[model samples]
Target: MIRAFANPHRFMALSRWLAPACLGVGALLMVWSVWQGLWVVPHDDYQGGDIMRAMFVHVPSAWLAMASYMGLAATGLIWFVWRHELADMAAKSIAPLGAAYTAMCLATGSIWGKPTWGTWWLWDDARMMSVLVMFFLFLGYMALRAAMETRQKAARAGAILAMVGAVNVPLIKFSVDIWSSIHQDASVLRLDGPAMPPVYLTPLLIGGLAHMIFFAGLTMMLMRAEVWGRRGDVLIARKLSGA
Candidate 1:
């Protein structure tokens, strides 16, 4: 199945329609989740009025931040093992988007923390610091990829780096547990199920799913654009060589 879509032509054909469909569904979900989270939901009595609502965006973006990098690592593995161009393209496309999400997570978490943790930032917190490191890794991957003179060289370098950096993913996930961090413990993915009430958890769930769909759509579109851009470069090179 992976090999089937390894063909760029097949990937492009499917993504052309799937991308838009995912985008539409993602937009609708975003609207619904935002409404459910911001207006419809009641404020947490413990967490300072409505300010706690930032969790709707903060938590979801953080999840996507980590999840997106994991996707990058997975594709990187495929490319390294199989030398699949589409997988390499997908990993390349994920770098910026993952970086953006990680940055947003840090920013929003800072905003949410100001009210809840009484500070804009917390260097002592394990979860917070680990995520910052993850964002930096994303930046490093992008830089390394761009610095390479050839796509083949970039792919090999990127794949190795992505796989090595993936060690941080599990560290980020378990940081709160490993250390006495100020960040809240895992509530959503607990073995006992979500600790929050259904009312609060519902919008969070919607937000997470919405972000996932949006990420998928956006990544596919970016991959398609990258493919087209590279093809144009090749054509120009050929024309110049002929001339």
Candidate 2:
């Protein structure tokens, strides 16, 4: 499947309808999850009353932030090893979208924290600090690529940074467990299964699925744009050279 999609034509053809279908379905799921979270689900006094509703947005963003980075890293590694230009395109496309989700995670986290932790930022919290590091890693990946002189150079630089920065993803995931932090630990994903009750858990899971599907649609859309842009560049170069 991976090798099949390595051919840009196949990917473009497949994504044409798949992307829109994913977008439509994901949008519907997102709307339903949001409605359930905000209006249908009963508030949990143990967590933070209605404020727990933010989990629908924050948790999914956080999940996507980490997942997107891993996707970037995996594609980067593929390009680094196999010299696949499509993989490089994928890595490039994932970066900005990953950064956007990371930013959303950080902003929403701060909002949730201010009310619960009584502070907008926590300098010492391991999970918070690790996630912050991951955010910077995303920014640095983009900045490093932009600084390179050529597309090849940019992809090479970005791939190396992504592979190295992947160390942070695990750190972010385990930070809460490894260190003492105010943040709750593994409410949804746990060895013993989710600690959250059904009412809150169901919608939260749906929200996470919605975001994941939505992210996939967005990534495919961005990759499609990159493909078209690259084609345009090729045409411009050919015309300039009278090829």
Prediction 1 global C-alpha lDDT: 0.86
Candidate 2: stretches off by over 4 Å? 168-194
lDDT for residue 52 in candidate 1, whole number 0-100? 72
Best-fitting candidate, measured by lDDT? 1
Prediction 1 TM-score vs. true:
0.90
Tens digits of per-residue lDDT for model 1, 1-243: 888989999888999999999999998998899888889998876666788788788889989998888899999999999999999999998999999999999999888777666788876666677788889999999999999999999999999999988976676658654664454542221213336888888999999999999999999999999899999999999999999
lDDT of 2 by residue, 209-228 (tens): 99999888988998899999
Please give the range of 10 consecutive residues that has the lowest summed lDDT in model 1: 185-194
Q: What are the Cα lDDT values of the candidates? A: 0.86, 0.84
RMSD of each: 3.6, 3.7
How do the predictions measure up, each by TM-score? Answer: 0.90, 0.89
Q: List the residue pairs that clash in candidate 1.
A: none
